[model samples]
Target: MSKVILITGASRGFGKIWAEAFLKRGDRVVATGRNLAAIQDLVNEYGDRVLPIQLDVNDREACFAAVNVAKDHFGRIDVLINNAGYGLFGTVEETSEQEARDQMETNFFGVLWLTQAVLPVMRAQKSGHIIQVSSYLGLITVPVLGIYNASKFAVEGLTETLASEVKAFGINVSLLEPNGYATSWSGDSAFQTESMEIYNPVKEAFQQAASTPGFFGQPEATAEAILKLVDAAQPPLRLLLGAFAYPAVKAAYEERLASFEDWKEVSEAAHGTSIKTGN
Candidate 1:
């Protein structure tokens, strides 16, 4: 049976592609964004199957109302993909306190509110999937994008724990980690704070990297991977999409190993166990 899906940030990027893919597969979709006009084409083409909803995830009341509306319209929401987010670019020192808070509010709290709103319905039905769209930076951090990275890292941690918490309720929570997808991430990357005399050259370099097209992973690629993950009989807890994510994760693992070896004695002492017997 085809499922009914509600995707945030459906006006563009991966969410738009995801809405199209789900509709293409004969599933009913509630495509949502702050501006419904952007998804007018989907509504025009798919008519009743693709319902374009105007919503802003950052708004708590709106988030609840949107979930209620989708549930009321579809009878049940088989999948809720939390895809509304943005990027922040700057070193930690250069980023403003307000920008950091805004990043977390949208990226972390927005997902949290949406999940909370939808989970009750899913729990009542005893089945549904919650897909939280994070970034590769969720697992690994890079310089200059500190605040954005921190927000994603918070999502990764929250979703990982939520997956375990919701398992018994017949709800599956998964993290979607896509690396540098050709979305508006780079172009949309906002500088939280104006550069002081401290690091103008470094700031410029960071801006250049943010504007570089070579690092973008195609949005369709992430969209397709998300479709596959959603369709799987047993979806993974974390789906790392795109080429950039894989290598980045691998490198992060290797770095962890190196760090562990360097602090073997301390780690062993902390655990109150000898290194002789391996678990």
Candidate 2:
């Protein structure tokens, strides 16, 4: 019953907690991060049960190599948690082209590369789960995080399509859309663009909204939820974690639906009805 779970970004936050949780439940874990030192303690504590590898998700070759390492060590990988990504804070205009590309490379293309590496193995075995750690921003955007949102939105689309394509192979793909959690996600791990004086007011308001202090979800709880998801007979394609995620995502979709319906007539008018007797 003990399965091999490969987790990227296992050095800290939700990734670290999830790794520990799996270890506690007697599952084998291949924990990878850009910094080996970050996962050294886990390797020390869990010994052979944990394999800590240095991996930069943004590197395509490195992603494939890491998957090979895991497969070699564990014989097979049952779960892959794509948790390697950072928050990029800035307006679309404020973020540099390089910064935007970097964000996409890590958050979107990284997931794609890793998934591609693992799919062959899973396809041969006829069973596996791929979990993408997306964000509430994937569903709806807020100010100053457009690049980050774009990356996650890309992830959302990628994983959803992947799920449909691989269902016949017994592969389950999921997107975890977590809202604010008590993690370093907003601190050291986050990257910010050069601040513009004109956008200071908007930035200040966004910061104030984020800083409101109550009931941020804990990493451990999120880990537990993920474990439950992993054990379920049928896991969902999209899951929202944290208390804030549900209401916020629901409201966002509702508003989107309302807007679409309001414009439905105009949208339909754009295409005239085809004339009959064309045959």
Candidate 3:
């Protein structure tokens, strides 16, 4: 059965690709971005199957209004792809307070607001899917992208808790942990703080590493992965995309587990005399 899929940031990159894919598969799509002009072509190409709406995810009222508009137009929203976020490039010390807050507003709170807005509709229907486009950085960290990592980490926590809360309502929540993709995400779409001389070496290292061949995956492939997840009868709570994501995330968790085991004696000692609890 065709679905009514709502995607934010559908003007370009992975979001655009996903919208196109869903429409091509005969699904109704609500394509939204801050710039309506960017998605006007989709409406022209797909006709009534695509509804282009202007939405700035950071605006709480805008998020709610966008969902209402989508619901009114389509009568229901079967899936929501919360893909409206930008990368913030800077070390923790170099990023300003406002920069950190702005990053969280879009990447974390934006998802929260939109999800809250859609929950009522989904609850009434008794079925829906929410896909959060988080980053692999949510699981692991990079040197200069501290703020971006923090925002995604918060998303990781939010989506996991949400899955448990909404499962009984037939609402499925999933997180997509994608690695660096060959999208505008790191180009004009990225946000950067003022450069500090103390971090020049770190920045240079990252630049060199990013310039390496095949460092980024293609957005089309990521879109295909998302489609597959939506088609599954039982999708996983977390799906990692890109060739590097699986091994990278696995190694990160394994290493952390090893460190925890190494300090088991010390850790237990700290809890000495604590009452034993029943499982």
Give the number of the best model, judged by TM-score.
3
Please say which candidate is ahead in lDDT: 1 or 2.
2
Candidate 1 residues lying further than 4 Å off, grouped into runs, are: 189-192, 204-214, 270-279
- Per-residue alpha-carbon lDDT of candidate 1 for residues 60-164, written as tens digits (9 for 90 to 100): 999999999888998999999999999887778877778889988999999999999999999999999999999889999888788889999999989999998
Q: Tens digit of lDDT per residue, candidate 2, span 9-54?
A: 9999999999999998899999999888988888888899999999
Among all windows of ten consecutive residues in candidate 1, which has the lowest summed lDDT? 186-195
lDDT of 3 by residue, 1-279 (tens): 999999999999999999999999899999999888888888988999999988889999999999999999999999999999999998899999999999999999999999999999999999999999999999998889999999999999999999999999999999999999999989999989988899999999998988888889988887678889999889999999988888989999999999999999899889877667898
Candidate 3 similarity to native, TM-score: 0.97
Q: Which regions of candidate 3 deviate over 4 angstroms?
A: 274-279
What TM-scores do the predictions have? 0.91, 0.96, 0.97
| lDDT, residue 133, candidate 1 | 93
Instruction: Give all candidates' CA lDDT scores.
Output: 0.86, 0.91, 0.93
Higher-ranked by TM-score: 2 or 3: 3
Ranking by TM-score: 3, 2, 1
Displacement of the residue 204 alpha carbon in candidate 3, Å:
1.9
Supply candidate 3's per-residue lDDT for 170: 96
TM-score of 1: 0.91
